[model samples]
Target: MISAVVFDMAGTTIDDRGAVYRALRSAVEDAGAPVADADLQRWMGTDKEEAITALLELGGVQPTPSIVSATFRAFRATLDDLYRADPPVPMAGVEAALADLRARGVRVALTTGFDEPVVGSLLASLGWTVGRGPAHTVDAVVTTSDVRAGRPAPYMIHHAMELLGVEDVHQVLAAGDTVVDVRAARNAGVVAVGVCTGALSRAELEAEPHDHVLDGVADVPALLAGREARVGVA
Candidate 1:
């Protein structure tokens, strides 16, 4: 039986693209570098440092610490502005699913590629502060900072499971909207469920090694309930 669910914040639980892209474009522009749309989407689910560095490399520019920092700061500021102006909304059915899971005694943990402050701000602006029902109230929040590395490494999911006192990765279901998310879950030996709300195409996600692909977060509750009932009935 799965006792907990680990969610990828941006694309999985929320649309997750607005603030980050807004921030990235502004940051790149501010740093006097041209930001390409494809590059940004390609780097989703990656940490700020890695994504910016990759972006620079793709543009045939050397990734300098100073330039990266400047772009990151600009991106952060823009994201903050976007959140304040109009926060990203939760994907349809996300709230009900989260509530149903919790009511069933399932622990929830939000895992993200974002840093601490930005995640906090976004959640706050969206009225999703910890314990704010129907959307928030996760048992824990795990950011890239909480792990040794981000997605495709399994460190983040491993760290979250440890923090949540879960011993078996199989008891955790990791859900996200990117291939990296699926890779991370697989690396940690957990069940990986992919959603198409983010950049990756449904075909792309299906081609990957994910255990399951969900149309949206709305299907999670039914998925879990069905699995649980199947186990019990058997």
Candidate 2:
């Protein structure tokens, strides 16, 4: 049985209409560095600061602390404006899936590359609460700001486990929409699921190391239910 399901926020659960990628590209370009789509895709699920640094380097700019910080701030400001102008909506069936999981005694957590301020704004827009209480939509939220490092490292996933009191990695399922998300789950020794509703497509996600590549977050509850059935038969 899976004790917890850790999901990525932007693409997996929330449909931001690719605002994050656009903001990142705009930020890097405004810093006199050109960002390639492929390069931007590689950093989708990682920490924003780290993504800015890597994008800067890839764009042939020296990723100095000042430059990275400036670019990150620009990205944040752009994203905030974009989100405020057009608030993001939850992905189709995501809320129902979350409710279904929680109703089944499965803890649900949301992990993201966003910092606290951005996350707070996003959640407020969606009117979702983060806590272990029955009224909360999620058991916990682990952001890049909460961990030493972001995706492709297991720290965020491990932190979520800690927050949810999930001791065994094998009892966890971590799902996201980027390669780093799959890598992070693998690094954490948990089930890695890739959803094609965010940054990557089915073919792209299927090329990575993952246990399952689903169409969207809404499909997660059914996947877990199948696993439970198999376990019962065994």
Candidate 3:
């Protein structure tokens, strides 16, 4: 039986692609550098500083604290705009599924490529107070700052599992909307469930070692139940 469920926030639990893109573009543009949507997409799930460094290198410009700070400020502004205009909407069944999991005694955790401050801010805007809403309500949350590297590194997932006191990888289910997420789960030896709600495609996700793929987050419970039944059958 699965003891805990770990989730990726950006594209998995909440839809923030537009905000992310807008913020990233504003930052890049503030540096007087041109940015394209394709390039922005490539930077997803990556560390912001790293992305800035890469962007600087590509532009043949040296990275400076001012540049990085500008980018961050712009990104934050975009995020704030998005929240004020349209606070994130929890994926269908996510609220229900989380409640069900709790009812079933399954512990829940969250792992994201985002930094803690950003994650905290985003969750708060969505009414995810620690003792209240579905945002800060998880048992554990591992962010980029808490781990050695971002997704595809497995450090975040490992940290979350550790926080949750889960020793067996098979007892945990990892879900996300990107290939990096699935790859992270696989690297950590957990069940990786991919969703299409993010920028990645089903074909791209399947190219990795994910254990399961769903149309969206709504199918997680059913997938878990099916996996349990299969385990019993075996």
TM-score ranking of the models: 2, 1, 3
Between candidates 1 and 2, the TM-score winner: 2
- What overall lDDT goes with each candidate model? 0.81, 0.93, 0.76
Better of 2 and 3 by lDDT: 2
Structural similarity to truth (TM-score) of each candidate: 0.91, 0.98, 0.88
Q: Count clashing pairs, candidate 3.
A: 0
The CA root-mean-square deviation of candidate 2, after full C-alpha superposition on the true structure, stands at 0.8
Candidate 2 lDDT, 31-139, residue by residue in tens: 9888888999999989999999999999889999999999999999999999988899999999999999999889999999999999998999999998876799999
Per-residue CA lDDT of model 3 for 1-234, tens digit only, reads 898888888788777645676766677777777776566666666666667666655655667887777767777777678777877777777777777676666778877766888888887766654422334456777788887778778888888878888899989889988766787888888888999888888997788787888888778888878878999999
**Model 3 / residue 26 / CA error / Å:** 2.5
Leading candidate by lDDT: 2
Q: What is the lDDT of residue 133 in candidate 1?
A: 47
Global lDDT for candidate 3?
Answer: 0.76
Q: Could you tell me the TM-score of candidate 1?
A: 0.91
